[model samples]
Target: MSGHSWLLKLPLGKCKSTFNLEKAVCNHGFFMMAPNRWIPSSKILQRPLRLADNTTSVTVLISHPPDSSFLCVQVYHSQTPSPADQRAILKQVTRMLRLTMRDETIVTKFQSICPEAKDINFGRIFVRPLSLKMLSSASSFAIAGKRKRAKSEKLTTHEANNAAPMGNFPNFEELVNIDESCFLEKFKPILGYRAEYILELVEAVKTGRVSFQDLENSTEEQLCYEQVYQNLAKIKGFGHFTCANVLMCMGHYEIVPADTETLRHIRQVHGMKNCNKKTMEEEVRKLYDKYAPFQCLAYWMELLDRYEYKVGKLSELSSSRYHLISSVLFQEDTSNK
Candidate 1:
């Protein structure tokens, strides 16, 4: 990609577009997911957006009209960007700001299908693992083959390798294990199995063994959901929970993925104990069956409620103490009033 400049217009107003800025960005799950190492501003979300081709990532700014009739985007680069650069940026932009060119039907359909319609932004769709556009002076920009130094202390080789850039991941021996160890050592307290699950998907996408783009663009004639599900299921570490999460984030919510967290949630929210997988699946389906294909979204929001998190802006959680974040959520506050 070369370095160049252009103003991409989101044609919403000419078509009566009402893109609520806050509702739009908060739905991406990026804000709630500080653990992923991507950070964003409250009003204007800026992060490093990796090109689909994975050659390099560029930092971009996202803002809109006062009425937010259209989304205005300007991609910044160190050099002139190639045609591929613009296309890649546009694809990412489309995925991140799903309301850029949408019609009223999109919101209508989303609200009707989502179980907890009042809690989520019906008009927005989020990309799995999410996309970020880096800002100047961000420490992550140096996380490639060369690692970034912490202001307090010099990082070891293991830390350096584990934080290696996506492109440099393949160079590491057993890329999967490197990701696993990073989670175990650095992020294990909060992430638990989720680190391995997301890392599995990330490594697969980064290395070209699993292509998010290919699956996204495949026509039903080219590849059906069953075939896609089977292919994802074959990945060494992705079981039902991980596969459903990846697929649901990709916009397929036919089935809601349930795990121990869900069982605990049922105990808290619905007083169900000893819920078996079969029974659990049946219960979730019946509960959100009216929403039909969007049961997963319903299930996800309800689980979020159990964690005492509403669908809204995110706050930073200290890495060392993150394991205790959830504990604070459901714990009763019986301090003297």
Candidate 2:
């Protein structure tokens, strides 16, 4: 685990195909999860991994065999990573590969609920509803002048409840991603109005109107997926497509966060020979209606099948595939859903 990066064998207990590995590290396709710098391709995923302390950066190559039981991760650098760094790498790997691990009982329960999804490589695409943790972190809130407190000094339940101002608990960056200058500069064409909406989202987070954790636990709190969807829809810049994908990321699979790519895939794979935006959406909802509450996951699985068959992997395809995911205009009155 040290001295000029080497290879390590880690078990992939629940992942059935190496294609899941591609999806795990490749969040947006053709583009990395912003600020993480995860480079992905058909055969390998490369990333500059920071140790848990953030003082060091190490590059690693990740891959696995299709349908194999274990993943092969290679850490390559001039210096060896520490044990903590190795653990960080593993933890991040597990996060991106959510449903592919042995110990994630939440994923298992979700699979039990959606047995139809047993064949789908669920991955981070789904999460345990109430217990799901948003990917927001202290660094995300640092721009607002809130720094994390000492980790060794744990807060009690009561202090934690009253500790909103104690540290950088508000994560404005996750939505706007101000940390990545490159994304803000060059990708303005991609995120245009959504970028403005992120500022509103940060305000919502800061004002305690909509906590990220609230969205995470919405399902358990008697908020039906649609109610939560409406709640999120109330936010500025959130339309059918943005709200849907946001909820999907928060573990709601009832909707597919549909876009033109969805339209294209439905046209190409579902045998819908001709389709405008309305027809494409109707076809998708019809195709996955039987799998309601699991439609997003189901749709993603189908799309992934076609995607892997086409390129054998996923890059930051989210932005590149749907070049106009948010900003593109569709047929009149068709809406963004």
Best by lDDT: 2
- What is the C-alpha local distance difference test score of each model? 0.50, 0.55
- In candidate 2, position 168 carries an lDDT of 20
Best by TM-score: 1
Estimated TM-score for each candidate: 0.63, 0.58
Model 1, 253: alpha-carbon shift in Å? 1.4
Stretches of candidate 2 exceeding 4 Å from the true structure: 2-10, 14-42, 49-58, 65-88, 100-135, 138-190, 219-224, 227-231, 271-275, 278-281, 305-337
Output the worst ten-in-a-row residue range by lDDT, candidate 1: 164-173
* Separate clash counts for every candidate: 16, 10
The CA lDDT at 52 in model 2 is 60
Error of 2 at 202 (Å): 2.9
Error of 1 at 168 (Å): 11
Candidate 1 C-alpha lDDT tens digits along 1-337: 1223345555554333435555555443454443233323435544445444443555555566576556665555544546775666666666655543332454556566663564454444455223322211113222223433221122235433322222211212233335455556665567777756657665776687876455555422345455666767877677888777766655566566787656556555675655556688776666767775566666665665444352123323323544564555445221211
